[model samples]
Target: MKFKTAFAAAAALTLATAANAQVGPEVGATVYGPEGNTVGTIEAMQDGVVVVNTGTYTAPVPANAFGEGPEGPIVSVTKDQLNAMMAEQEKQMIAARDAALIENATVLTADGVEIGTVTSIDGDNAIVTLEDGPVSLMRDQFATNETGALIVLATKDQLMAALNGGSVEGGEAMEADAE
Candidate 1:
């Protein structure tokens, strides 16, 4: 697989405490860098990862990458560094996604569950034929995982819910379109 490492290495031991002090960074809590500079705020916790909102972008760091500090939870990368890394990662991810998005290709969820088949591609949109029917989705929504498997950055249930709720732009449930 040609996937670049998706995770930042675990934060330095000095910055992280055991198990983030038996808990993890709470949402809205400020995250610090090793030098005690503000990196960002914890926006969410999902699947053992913490989403740190750096204003410019959100970076997904493993929960274990955080350590308790005198002021708050600390991560290894400074604000600027993390933001730059995230930007680079985003470019790489988009490139990988474009490479994998071929007609007839099977798309998988981030956790590796096959979600649908790519029936066609039009400009920046793709039509994936799910169980119900075809749904149009933006190409930006697709990316490859650490194993280079073509996947979206959501769980199967989340994608299904979005399709069912008609929340994804240009995505209409196949059955709903018939009605």
Candidate 2:
């Protein structure tokens, strides 16, 4: 009984101490790894997620993924491991973007409706021939569907509305959600 009581007191004290040592996730704060090594800097925090800039890439990690470390808030992965993973992700993203912006490729609407075909590549713009005329879209506005089909990142009605300078029939409040 004495051993149990002492253990409980010690555990409570440890918890109290740990609770006081928590590192706040703030912008420009250095985040550490489990072994107290530099993981990255917290670039931004929003909606319980922190965007950590690891020099190579900006990674969005859940706030709960961090733990109280000896020196600062610690993420599970090491700096090198996180950098490697981010590098791979960046590469894949570039590849997917490239695949969707090819010339002569069929451009489908966000809802899988056929809209146009890529007629020409003008610098950073992909000139897609829509129903009425050819429209140039930024490279980033192109996307690949689940089956690897090239698509514009907007609906048919949205595209028509933008081109005609009028409200679309089926357009919703399009939030600027970057892919």
Candidate 3:
């Protein structure tokens, strides 16, 4: 009788552990909409929010919006519903990005070191005027800090080198523009 009870308890514990294995959706995992169509891929988890990248844009949805499905984590909403939500978020993000006033904005490094100033934004790149010269950086490299200052992942030295027609450690020089 005791042996049976111990085995039952152990099985229950194992099942419980398995069920609670993941507290949220796994990053890089595919997320399906209610229609069983792949809507987006999970990019990350921030402050209990699940960030998903739909083909059009990336948006954060509440963690409770997902549930376990046969294939993977599925969103409770339909594809249209999910798209609508993402579209709204995208509009807000675009509005914020547009209002950032990138031109003449001081660009800083991750350590808060000022590197350059943004001279212009061309499509997916930002033209920055560093100490040496002007260098173009991908838009992804530019972000607004907590205080709303434009920040870049590159350091001052890196920006200077790239601006001077020399390749920085993580930046590529514009060969065509160099000549």
lDDT of each: 0.81, 0.79, 0.74
Ranking by TM-score: 1, 2, 3
TM-score of each: 0.61, 0.60, 0.56
Query: Model 3 segments beyond 4 Å from truth?
Result: 1-10, 13-29, 42-51, 58-65, 102-104, 118-129, 133-142, 152-158, 164-179
User: In model 3, what are the clashing residue pairs, if there are any?
Assistant: none
Candidate 3 or 1, higher lDDT = 1
For lDDT, the strongest prediction is 1
Question: How does residue 175 of candidate 2 score in lDDT?
Answer: 29
The 10-residue segment with the lowest total lDDT in model 3: 170-179
lDDT string for model 1 (36-118, tens) is 99999999999999999999998999998998888888998999999999999888878888999989989898668998898
Clashes of each: 2, 0, 0
Top model number, TM-score: 1
Candidate 1 minimal-lDDT segment of 10 residues: 170-179
Ranking by lDDT: 1, 2, 3
Scored by Cα lDDT, where does model 2 land? 0.79
Report the lDDT tens digits of candidate 3 across residue range 1-179.
99999999999999988876664489999999887889789999878799888877677888888888878889877656777987886676556555664789887876689876888887877787766677677776666667767776556666555556677575554321311
- Residue pairs clashing in model 1 are 16-67, 17-67
Give the distance in Å from residue 44's predicted Cα in candidate 1 to where it truly belongs.
3.6
Candidate 2, 1-179: lDDT as tens digits = 99999999999999988876565677888999877889899989999999999887799999888886677778989989998888897788668879677788998988999987887887777778776777767777777888888877778778676666554355543222111
